[model samples]
Target: MTTHQLTEAQKKQWEEDGYLVIPSFFDKQETKEMLDEAKRLCDEFDVDGHPMTTFKTAADGEHVGDEYFLESGDKIRYFLEPTSLSPATPDTPSRLLVPPSQSINKIGHALAILNPVFRKHTLESDKIRSVAKSLGAQESPRVLQSMIICKQPRIGGVVPCHNDSTFLYTDPPSAIGAWVALEECTPENGCLSFLPGSHKLSRTATRFVRAPGGGTTFIDVPGVEPNEEKWDDMDGWREAPCSPGTLVLIHGSVMHRSPPNPSDKTRIIYTFHMIEGGKGVKYDEKNWLQPTEAMPFPVLF
Candidate 1:
């Protein structure tokens, strides 16, 4: 596979804005194949004995979890869009009935290890290593998680403002996300927005993990909460809408969010985060998602 490296100007922009947009990172053919693969996965997964437990967001906009949701941490599963369920009627038994055309929110967390197509694009590609080197990651970076975010038309849920390192955190916070657009993204279709220079402020404020009792929980960091005031200021933020094949590199500490889709178009994107796996950088064992013995995260050297 052909590899693309970051230019000096792009590296400078990343340093200043905590993000970099690489236009046409993938060709039209590649993007179309990826989108096709995503659609196939969403439509064909068999849930014979397993419960059809879809991911749901609470009223507070946090993810609601159960045993089924927690067990899917390292498995390929389909999560339904929050608004895809039909309301209960007098004849309907359950309130959450999957609509005729099922709206899937995402299919993720284990695609790189289980799916050959996704593995080729992620672990087998040299582009990830080249980008890591440009970001000054001396050691080989390891892929932590991979997910395809499907912002379905009209009913796509809003993702609240937050940094990625809070979820895929390592000691000293070396997480970075490579987000590839599989279709044209626009503000009307729930494209991502970023707070420039937010990474330089603080590494992380809180982390999301499985609680001792049950369900997912967000734990606060001891002495860090940078960008709270700046995050409140809306002027410094900007929307990053791009065409198909564009790749957006996100700094771990940068605050970013995407609004709900209000348009008829669907915004499909494949994203994954990488963390430095050097001797000194500690990947916390308590981070909720642990690597299985059969397939650990691939290292990109």
Candidate 2:
């Protein structure tokens, strides 16, 4: 079996292109464990007294933020599938079309520290930490965001093309996404597609930050306001298909998106972002997720 350390070829690919799809990064047992755990989380989640917020994305880059979203940084929170709900009236919220177990779009933000299973496979593994060091995380890499993106079956939730640094920002924009496939991901089932070398276009990205008055707003990135033109592709966009255990290391600035899962199979994935943390790196306060002293970002050792 190959070790988890980045090979010379993998390093060269990352250096030149800012993205890599490393096959079999995890073993079968490891992949199976995570998939089963994600299903268990979805099955055991209770809907009583919980907010039924649906995750929605716009073609134009505008994002909708609520208190439930803003406060989820330090906690494990569930977001409902936008397609799994009925239209809302004045008083009542959107009603769920499916049962609670199958209605979640994702569980996110703090799973690496809050959940033992994720923590073990994530922060606690020597192989994972070794990989982090190879990625230039310096002596310490602070992981603040971890997610189980459950591309729910058949509802057709599609994420528009966007980068990760827009949400998790640093001064020089240092965020690396560690995306592991828990099940087979195919183009037909909304697997990730990438515009390779897009990260080198601009280290500085347009951020989606918290607005002072209320809600969220886009700022800093030198460009026009939210519109379809921003999402227009120039060419060289390609789909990346993966089997179980494949790990795709994505540059925070690389433009990537997934189509709707028209097939019955769910394209579930486990992903987390690690940003450079130290004196030189500055994590902005205006970013969507803020780390309190009580729940500081977990460092990989």
Candidate 3:
């Protein structure tokens, strides 16, 4: 079912909790294909440190060759604001084939569900219809393709707490992100955490910075401290750890992120976005690059 067909109870839960985990969003076959496709793309895609231009470094004493030693906090900020930094440099490979915006295409039937299931049958799907109705944009459920987030064990990355909207650049603020876990995601494996009611915060608070490996971070504006006390008091502000095929829907403005995956296995997950297209929205060419243009994939409803 599409998000549009969500019941009142489901919608209420999302509105109150900022996110809801819908168990069994994908079957075993679909899950396997999605993981396989993501791995295939990731193999072709290279991962490098963020470039030096996007942010300023702190006065840390450690030095590694010509690179500056950035503090833990600065590293978070630096990667988040990669307006200038890049994954590759002059000494690296030449003639970059991947887009700076790391949207990759389907290698197999992996992402076929996103295009056909969500787009072609969106009007007929209950879930999509319910979500579209809630957003007050029933005619346009701007559901983007599903993306795979793979983090290797021990070397799993740290994604500091941030929002999802900053990267979309959507005005009037009505985008939603639905993440489906392909593997068991525990706190040890860097499960996502969210600040309850954080979505109620102004859209202005969400900031975008270029992230490592050519991704982007949707962070809170600098110097604006989050309500730690409120988060502590609210039961809703919690960690969401799920087994494979679990789906969690989150508002785009919610403050959220995943910590490092300290586990021994790789963590894989699929993330998709829904945009409401009534409020005079314009695409941000720099960020919205999809993989279909560079690579083609099959679509299956």
Candidate 4:
């Protein structure tokens, strides 16, 4: 699980850009094994919404907006859209969701991922934490939210742009989200597009709701411009593209969204969020349909 320790230069880049791409962050063998396990899960699970194999061609022969046509998937089943049973709600207090793969091998791939490398990549890494401290973070962060996104091809829908801070009711108003790319990502393949420094802007949207047609949309934070160019110019506003072994570390305030997987291949990615440990922030678990703990698992520090 060893990796090239974060460098001073990379740390500086993260502080300035708001995000950094760490290449080859996972050991090749480990990555391969994880991918193998994901494939196995796809086979065993009763995938419902759209099979990860359909694609819609564009008039220009480009794969741009095709992702908006595919359906979203629940690891337990596929979803044509967000349902009452789904926890993808914005008003919800605690939104963390874990994958079903955790029980596969007992000490299987899931545990390996939760092991040192992945956790340390964002939590304990001195370089990353140093950058965080410079940006005002105190203490190591907790892996408060985690989930696996199994993006099947043509399984498209728009997860509109919004700040994660809006959903997390906390003071000092901050958190960190890391999205790991499990497959090669491209715009046509439904890769994520961010509004650059949109995270620094004041809350443009206060509530989250689904668009009439089907896609999800958020109410904009007052005072922010709907202008596109402003966000497009942010230092870290770049569209991140990665191979199977890269990770995207993002601040909680950052505004981001991704469309459906339009390509025939599946774009599987895992996402995790962490808050400064001992922050005293509590999650209202009473609303949960299932008996979920405030902090479901121990922070892997």
Query: Which of the numbered candidates is closest to the native, going by highest TM-score?
Result: 2
By summed lDDT, the worst window of 10 consecutive residues in model 3 runs over 71-80
* Candidate 1 lDDT, 1-301, residue by residue in tens: 5778788898899999999999898888878888899878867755455354555444363775677666555788777776776654799632334442346788878887678888887887777667677778447788867888888888888887778888877877888999999999999999999989877876586777778887778787678764446474667788999999999999998888889998989899998888888888877666767777776777777
Please give the lDDT score at residue 116 for candidate 4.
48
Number of the candidate with higher TM-score, 2 or 3: 2
Using lDDT, give the best candidate's number: 2
TM-scores for candidates 1 onward, in order: 0.90, 0.93, 0.60, 0.60
lDDT of 4 at 198: 58
* TM-score of model number 4: 0.60
Candidate 2 TM-score over all chains jointly = 0.93
- For candidate 3, write residues 43-120 as lDDT tens digits: 554435533322211122111211221222111111112221236667973232324323221111123243343233
Descending-TM-score candidate ranking: 2, 1, 3, 4
Please report how far candidate 1 places residue 244 from its true position, in Å: 0.7
Stretches of candidate 1 off by over 4 Å are 45-52, 56-61, 87-101, 225-227, 230-232
Stretches off by above 4 angstroms in model 4 are 1-4, 47-138, 204-237, 280-297
Query: What's the distance in Å from true for residue 12, model 1?
Result: 0.4
User: How accurate locally is residue 187 in candidate 4, as Cα lDDT from 0 to 100?
Assistant: 80
| Over 4 Å off, model 2 | 1-3, 137-139, 203-205, 221-231
